[model samples]
Structure formats: structure tokens, C-alpha cells
Target: MNAPITACYPDPGTARPLTGLYLDHALPDRGRHGPFIYANYIASLDGRISVPADTGGQGVPESIANARDWRLFQELAGQADLLLSSGRYLRDLEAGTAQDSLPIGIDDAFSDIRAWRVRHGLAPQPDVAVLSAGLDFAVPRRLLDQGRRVIVITGESVPDSRVQAHERAGTEVIVLPNVARPGGAALVTALQALAYRRIYTVAGPFVLHTLLSANLLDSLFLTTVHRLIGGQPFASLCEGDLLAETGDFQLASMHLDAHGPGGCTQTFSRYDRTPGP
Candidate 1:
């Protein structure tokens, strides 16, 4: 209900709250993890993250809504440490598109990532780590060419042949146990081992759900657009018993776009508001 938030994001019938919500009971304090991990996403009013045909470009059915969505989207991307994602999102999003491919014969394209890392006192290029059962050769190649580290976390059953080739190419291919929990654990542990303390997981419902259910999400950033984007299938997390347990969550800081469109960007934040038993 902040003035600036409504003014910057004044779309009616929308849930564009200035400050969103954060729900976590694992950590006893705000900065519990050596470095906190932020899980971010954008959902429709009806809780959909995708369109019916999977052709809505990037989930927004309305132009204005898309603009607002991208504003927050870019902001989060600009501030994240390691952009962690799963192989499925890469394939579905065609993340292998050569549009930003290495910027061959040019040093210009690498500047952004380089500068961001330096500004944050991190490596020149943040690692673009993928959680996969095997190497995503096509995507990793492009990321590597852009000065980004291509790390593939796989399982024991991953084909031996591909693993060998990827390692030879200087890609960090980690093979973990064949269990589901171990996969994520291996990923977090490996990133930590490689000095990647702050990680950002941006992906589809399944990946997000896993982190949330595992109580690994330290923070969540979301952009709630103002529209009815029905038809898209979504994995709803706001249901019945889920609602009661989620109330322990709290809001930290609120940032209403001081100067911008009448649409506000809320940072629904909550630290360790309640003491853990």
C-alpha cells in the first residue's frame, strides 16, 4: 500500500506489491548460509509461469505486464552472483542461442560480466553452472566462450564417454551419487568448494520447488504482474495447509520505484524473523 509502489506499478487487479514475502525456517538468522542463496521467479496472477503453447515468449501474455516483468527480471540478474539453472530450462529456453556467443574477435561483450564480477569482488566471469545428469555440450560451449565457467554437475550413471570429453575440454564435470538429494547437495558443495559462496537459482517450477521444499531458499525475489494469464500450467505453492505454515515468513525492506512508471517494484523481504526451535 505504499504510495511510490502503487505509482510506479499501478496496474489494477494486480498483485504488484512493493515488498514481496520470504518464507524459510531452516536458518536461524538472516545471513545463516556463508553466503545467502536467492531463488527468483515471475508468476501470473493465477500462479502460471508459462503459457499454454510454450510460445508466449517468456510467460507474459500482455505487453505492459511483460515490460514490468523484465524490469525486475533484469534487476535481479544484474545483482546475482552465480546464475544457477537446470539443464531442462536451458534446452526449453534454447539457451544455446549464439546471439551472445563469445563475441568473437571482440572484447566488448565480455565487459558486463567482467565488470559485474569485479564490482562484487568476484571472478571476472561468474560461473554458469548447470545441474544435469550429464554434460550439456552445446550450452556449456557458448557459456565458456563468453569467459563464463561452465560447470556440469552430473550423477554416477552419466555416460562415461561424454564426461571424459567434457573434462578434457577444461569443463568442470562433477559426478555425484545417483540420489536426488545428493545432486543438489553436490551442486551447493561444489560451488562452495570452488569459492562460489553466493549463488542464484533461476528456473522452472520443479527446480524452485525442490529448493523450497528442501528449505534451502534463503531469499525469494518475485515480480507479480497485473493481469489474468490463465491457461498456463503452474505448480501452485499457495494452498491450504501450506498457507498456515507460510505465515512465519516476514518482510524486510520495501523499495517502491521512486521515479518510474506508475508501476512499483516491491522487494518483499523477510529475514530470520522467528527463532528456530
Candidate 2:
């Protein structure tokens, strides 16, 4: 395990600010394959996603680090018209409970993320989509209450009662026969069909691994705090060497903070997956 690197982010007092740069950084030129989607994340120098102590959860950071992370999160969260995540992330980050519903204040907090999008003339409330092996009624009900459209993707057949519950609360429940793995492409198709562009996928390693392995990622944003921690590399985006093939790849431009509390924001050069050789 690598040790945590000591880093610092802007103190929110900088006058020039990052808003415009962020807006420009997020919206890439569109392509026929689809609108550009960016994957946003933060990690320790060693590439760990969560805290290592198993303090019954991912690692914890000091207030400054936490603030910087949330700042990055809010910025990216504001840019996305649709926020997608695996059921596991929701469970770990939001619920931490087996029941389907989120806590009462959850909707309002999400509303703030939504408001940022609206200020930029993006969607008022992004369609919050979750993929799971089974139904979790808590999510749809909680998210819908916040005026966000909640979408539940499940592999198992959804019971009518759950469907009715979602509809009553103004959420959408989608059922798919095959959702065990590699379901992200299908989920993207489904969301596109529902008119959701500018999708953002955030989650733990497994879902991240699935999408990368499927070659579905278009952009990757990382906040590299100059710290070392213990964790594994995220799964590679492809099965084999893809850079050497013809018509196979493109450049990804990245912007790093000229200074930091040892923290830097890195955005991946966006591109489509080239066909396999």
C-alpha cells in the first residue's frame, strides 16, 4: 500500500475561479456514437477508491481533503444531465441500509446538484438511474420526492406492486432479463432511448471495471491528491493492447492544477473505442 500524499486544494477564496474552465472542460464535441460521457473519480496516490482501514467502510480523509473532493464532485455532478451508479455505490455511500428508501434529507441534497445543472441550462433534475440485481423501492421513492426521475434497472422481474409504487411516486422502473454483468451498454441504450444525454457513471471498482472492460467510457476525471495509499488499479479499459491498432484510438487532453494542497484535477482526453484488431 502506498502512503497518502499530503495535498491541498483551492480554499474557495480564489478570485479567478474554476467555473468557466470546468464548463468548457465538461462539454466535448458530440459524435454519432453518442454524446460524450465523462467518468469522474478521486483516488489516493496508490489508486485506492476508499479508505483502507476497513473502519467498516472506505478510508476517511481530513476535512480539507473531503471538502476538495466534494467540490470536484459537485462540479462534475452539476455537469451531468444524468447520474448513473451501481446499486453497490448507493448502498455504500447513501443508504448503508437494506431498505430501499434513502433518508429524508437525501432528496433536498440532490436537488442542490440539480439546481447547479439548471443554472447552466441543463436539466432541472437529472434522471438518477440505478442498476441492481433486485428491486430497492427506497431509492425511487426518495429520489422522486426530490422531483428527480428515479430509474431502477433490474434483471429480475419487477413485482407489480413495486412498479405501481414507483409510478405513484413519479419514478420509472425498467426491467431487463440480463443485467448481471456488462449491463452498462444496455443501460446507456435504455437511458438514451429515454432521452438522457450527458450521462455520468460513478461507482465502486466493480461497476467501474465493468464499463471500462466493455470499452464504454469516453472520459475520465481524476483528482490526484499528492498522497499515497493502498489499493488496486482499476480494471483496464480493454482486454489487450489497443493503442497500436489502426483507427484504434485518439488523444485525451488533461488539465492539472498548477498548485495544490498536493491535489490536482486530471481530466482524460475523450475518445470513442476503436474496433478490435
Candidate 3:
């Protein structure tokens, strides 16, 4: 049981091509509100997005991170106007624990995406917006060398000195008037004002939970690898206590690839937010 992906849910016919599956989506046009926000995640059958790594940091289990999923992941990143991330990622980079770079379309594997960005009149790499209330990480020098516009978003309680530090590095720092946590509406309003129409969040689950809680997420792309990973100290796609009202998403598309690591299979699905004001 090993073959390329085939469309299943809405329509079924020829084996759909794997590449450009996500890239074909007109993400920027669907933003009637602030921005069309989306996130990409690959999980195991048991819903494990990450497990304990040998280096003490959590990592995506290799068995669940097959190459096909990675291709779609890159495609998602390739279409973003800005990538929503966290300051903790910079801390991890300094600690030599970070997994991947913040920039997309740089490596030869996806160099074509950079060209595609140019063709579509977008920058080589999407700008990066780091969400943090602590404001305690140094922007890596290599990121600047790659020419990514790094914007820092922090709460009002943060010290002015911290904001200036990032500004001094030519990194624009946005200090929102949020104390406990920047709820979904405030954050999206700020992003929308900047004219960022396509927001792709690659940050951890906390950010996704924040967006979903506010019903601000527009799309969710998930790849479920047909494998079970059960272990202590693992993480899932969304985390936190049960929400007052769980978010609802209607499936937009689904595809099945009969090949995964060790003869397993994978299901790639996309869900759109139910229409609401």
C-alpha cells in the first residue's frame, strides 16, 4: 500500500499531484477580517506533535515527519506575508537547540519557492513577527544576513529598554497594550493595520490556542501520519484547559497518501473556519 496522494473527500479522480497542493490556495484573497491566518502541523495517529529530544528540547518524532509532509509545510510558509513565531525560538537558537530557520525559500530544496515569491511580487522571504511578553532574546545575526524583517510584539508592561534594543538593531518592535496576555482580537488588529494579509504561524501550540480561542484562525493544515506514539512528556497540536466554547472548523479538503515511514499512510487535511462575524 504505497502510492502518491489521491483526492478523497470532495472529489475523486486521477491521483492528484503532491506538490503545489497547498501553494495553489489563494490564501491572501480570503481575508475579510484582519488577516487570513493559518498554521501547519504534522502529528502522529495518537496526536503527538512532539516528543522529548535527546537534547532536552521537544522535537517532532522522526517517524511522523516524513518528506511529503515537509514539502507541504514549506509550501505553507512560502505563501505567508509574515510568520508568527515566538521569542523563545531565538533563545533556543542561541542555546543550539533550534530545529529550523525562520526563513523559507532559502535552501536548495525550496529555492524554487523564492523564485515563485518573486513572480508573485512578494519578497524573497516573508517577514517574521515574534510574539513575546518577556522580550528577552537576541535576534540572531544570521537572520539579518538573510534579510528577514524581524518584528517583535510584546506587552505594554515590558521595559522600554527592551524595545529600544530591538529597534537599535533595525528590528521594528511593537509594544501592544496587553498585560496578562495579548488576546486574539488585539493581536490581529495590530497585524491587520500593518497590511499583512496572510499570517502563517509556525510558533508553538500556545499561539495556535490563542488564535483559536479568539476565533481568529482562518485555516488549519494538518498532516496525520498513520503511526502511534505514546510516551510521557509529549505535546499535542493544541493545548490548554478546555475552552469555554471549542472552535469549529469545516473540512475544506482531504487527501490520502498510501505511503509513509515503514509502509504506513498519511492523511493531509485542510479546514476552513466556519463563517462568522
Candidate 4:
């Protein structure tokens, strides 16, 4: 069952009640020439994104037992024009026990959001874009088939054999200039070239850290579950050394789900990047 939203603050400054918020109407406006990047992540109450030594801890049975979170996840995926993810996350999905296709929704649902996309002259399904330094991981064969569009972004150092393999599989492989690392700027440029204006990223900590460091992240939609996972060396939502300058995010909206099963509480918060002074 879909959890009822107890409270919604659409505008933090005004704090007015927002009623009847649906996924189709809640999506952000796309830019004309560039991408508006937003990320969605779920964390534990103790601020852990993953369990110790296990990167796929977020998929544990105890972590994602909430129906409300799953509903929101599907809604976000259904509304995005493009789904950006790191190569590691893609590989993890392949190796892990998760579902093969994108988790758009359960029971083949989200018809309303799909219809909205079509009415707006957009594809019903979002394209998947994977970012990696080198095309070393195994790209999903199903994703390479027709009817599905997949974009692979990597540096020039990727082997010619790998590039050919992806191309032969009908994947659009983009090779950027070789650098110490593939920064978010390069990824944004590639996204712009493809005319993808609304991008939703479901990335791990490392990718989030890089995007945040590059000032490429526009907003973050975080769900904090009421659980304390503090046994092992878990990673946070943003993992890396402290930045010389910190990024500031202003809370744009917040929603509360108080009637979660098992006395659990989930708080959904949206933070937009604050413009530089």
C-alpha cells in the first residue's frame, strides 16, 4: 500500500501546505540547453549509506523494507528523462540479486507518469547513461538490444576492443579526452550533446562525491530511514576527503511519512544547491 504523506512543505521559506502532490506534477522543469542534475539516495538514521565492506548494503532486506520509499523511487525514475549512474553501480546490479531492469515501479505500474511523458512529447522510458573512467565492467546485454538506448561515457584510454564491443552491441559509447579522472564536467558536456535536460542520478558514494566536488549536482532528494546501522565501516551519502570549500544546500521541500509499518519513520528532504555569493 502507498504510504500517506502526513505533511508536505513544498516551499521551505513559505512553509505552505501542498496538497495532492503527484509525481507527474512534481517533476522539475528541464533546462533548454543543459542538464538539471538531481540525485536520489536513502540513508540510515545514523548516516550510513552502506554496511561495512559491503557496497551493496543499501539493498539489504532490512534497509529497503519500506513500501513508501519504494513508491517514491519508482515515481522519481518514471519522471526522469535520463537515468545517470556510475559504472560500479551498474556492475553491482549485474552481480547482485536485484532486479534486471530499472526499478521504475512494481506490478508494471506508474502508467500515469508514463502517459504524462508521452503527452509532453517525451519517451515513456528514460535512457540509461553510465559513467566510467574505462569501459572495463560488463555492460548488460539486454540494455544493448534495440528498443532500449544506453550511453557509455569513458575516457580515451579505454581499449579499442571494449569500444568496438559496445558499439557492436548498439550502445552509444562516448570517449572523452584522457585526464587523471573523468570529472563531472565532461559527463555534463556529453549529456548536453545528447540534449538530455532532465537527469536523475542513482549513484553510490564515490560518484556522488565527485559530482559534488565538481559543483555539478543541482539538487538532492534524500530519504532518511529511522534505523541505526553502525556496526561496520559504512559509507555516507558523500564519501571522500573534506573539500577545501564546502557546498551549501538550501532545503527546498520536505515530506514526512509518519505511519510507516513497525513504528518506522521516513523523512524525505529536497535540498537545492545554493548559488555562490
Q: What is the lDDT of residue 90 in candidate 4?
A: 72
lDDT of 3 by residue, 1-277 (tens): 1246888777965587787788765566456477788998999999999888788878778778887888888889888878998877778877888878777856687876777788778888888888888788888888777788888887777888988888988788877765546556677678777788688999877778877877778889999999998966768888877876687889999998887788898899999888776
For all candidates in order, the CA lDDT equals 0.49, 0.51, 0.81, 0.69
Q: Report the C-alpha lDDT of model 1 over 218-254, residue by residue, as the tens digit.
A: 7666555444546634444322234223423444443
Error of 3 at 248 (Å): 0.7
TM-score per candidate:
0.66, 0.66, 0.93, 0.85
lDDT of 2 by residue, 1-277 (tens): 0112221323232333333334435465342336555666565555555543333444333311444444456666667667776666565545453222322113454454555566667755466777666455355345666677677776545566766675676666787556653355575566457665676766555555555544556666665555665443333222234423232344333334433444443321233444441
Segments in model 1 whose C-alpha atoms lie over 4 Å from true places: 1-31, 53-65, 93-117, 134-137, 178-188, 235-248, 254-277
- Candidate 2 yields a Cα-based lDDT of 0.51
Per-residue lDDT over 147-235 for candidate 4, one digit per residue giving the tens place of the 0 to 100 score: 55888888777788988987886788888775535665676576678887678887778778877777777888888887776746667
**Candidate 1 global lDDT:** 0.49
Q: Which candidate's lDDT is highest? A: 3
**Shift in Å, residue 99, candidate 3:** 1.8
Task: Please give the range of 10 consecutive residues that has the lowest summed lDDT in model 2.
Answer: 1-10
Tell me the lDDT of model 3 at 141.
80
Misplaced by over 4 Å in model 4 are 8-24, 31-33, 52-61, 106-108
